[model samples]
Target: MYAILGEDKSDVATLKVILKRLIGDDSIKIKTKGYNGCAELLRKGAKQITAFSKLGLAIFVVCYDSDGKDPAKRYSDVVSKIIKPTGLKNTICVVIPVQELEAWILADIQSVTNVFSSWKPKEINNPESIDNPKEYLEKLSRDCNRRPRYNHATHNEKIAPYLDLDKLKCKCPSFLPLVTLAENHDAHVAK
Candidate 1:
């Protein structure tokens, strides 16, 4: 079981599902509440770790967009806040994608092309370099088939599925941590 803490629900809807697959649990892994925002997530985390951690929970995965901040710095800052309250080191993994979650979406050229015909994925070799990924996504979404009114409520989920995990993991340095977390989670479950 696990808890998904993120800056917002839109940021992690697909991620939680992908992570479950990534974790490689042999049997169905029951998770605590599906997902919660970081502020609320932090409070929930503080509660579960202190009061209910023994309830088959193995890890707390925190996902946050860098939003112009340094990914490493953002990751460390978040870790400092949660570690003392949760007393979890290995069990708490922070996923900070540079620029924003959209950066990861753009990392996979195939996925980007699947959604938008106008985007040149090969040109986006470094997603982190883009100043405003969300804007680019919106523009590209308009260029998608029939300009299908792209918004977080409608299209965010569509992006992750098309995203090639191998490509995303290899191209985005920030995304590698997510893969590492999955590997570690699998090891812990194996034990």
Candidate 2:
């Protein structure tokens, strides 16, 4: 079992779908448990969530956007307040790229083209550094052969299944933790 506590529905949904694919188990329990935002999770809900400690092979993953703030500080916040308080082992915190979580989707350009067909993406060597990723994604998504609504609820879940995690990890530095978590998840499953 893996639990994703994050900002919104679309963002969490994207992570859930990607993790499900990464584990190659459609039946894997990747619990979203409603769309809990980071503020709420850092507050009351963090203590209330017990699955991390109780469930075997569990990983409690938190996803939050950098918001142009210092990721180290944000990471420390989660560590001190959430992870430390719960004393949960195998917790992974990933600071999403500039501005918002949508930038993660753009990390894998090939995947976006695969879903949208002939969707041309500009060369982005460092997707994490891209300013205003949501706006960029929205513009690129509009140009797709088949225009799909670009958002957490609409496009994120749709694109995640087709996402090439390897390619994504290569392009976005922040995505490395996700790869690490997937490896850890696989190791736990094998055990």
Candidate 3:
């Protein structure tokens, strides 16, 4: 079983969609715990570790938009204060700063906009004026591909400029374990 702790319901839904696509809905159990912010999620995640450990479950914590803070420091804090003390390694934490679970979905921007309709910015008031942030982003992505130099910024740059890319880069390696684990689990069931 896998449990995902996120900043909000939307983040959890996005993660659930990805997890279902990658590992199959039946093979993994997904649950959402809301937190005011990354720090709070870390706090709750610590407690979750104990309960999950008892159930012999694997837990994955994914947080977004860490507000320019060092993800490694945050992760280490959780591990040292919560996970390690509990002696749990089956649990893995992956943080995606600036946008949470939305970053992982393979869908184009428009798809994302549809999922987060309520949160769409009113600045794009014109019904046809790139009203959907996701759609706007998808267009930008397509344009970037057409003109390579137009890639002055990466996807994260366009969607979430506030993120500390340096910190995100440092913690990205942590996600490999979960990705590999999910892939392996999928392969086993397929066979």
Which candidate number has the best lDDT?
2
Global lDDT scores for all candidate models: 0.66, 0.69, 0.48
The model with the greater lDDT, 1 or 2, is: 2
Error of 1 at 55 (Å): 3.5
Model 2 lDDT per residue over 1-191, tens place: 67877767777788888877766778988777544666876784366456545655366677776777887888888777767777655555554555677667767755666666657566566777778787777766665534654555677788888877777777777777777777677677665
Per-candidate TM-score against the hidden true structure:
0.78, 0.82, 0.54
lDDT of residue 112 for candidate 3: 26
For residues 85-112, what per-residue lDDT tens digits would candidate 1 score against the true structure?
6775547767887887777777774565
lDDT tens digits, residue span 1-191, model 3: 66666666555655555555545454467666657766676666667657765775665655544333565675566666656766766646565442233332222233323333332322221211223334455555565443332121233223332322233233344334445656677444454
Sort order, TM-score high to low: 2, 1, 3
For candidate 2, give the lDDT of residue 35. Answer: 45
Error of model 3, residue 140, in angstroms? 13
Give me the candidate number with maximum TM-score: 2
At residue 125, give the lDDT of candidate 1: 79
Error of 1 at 95 (Å): 0.8
- Residue 126 in candidate 1, Cα distance off native in Å: 1.2
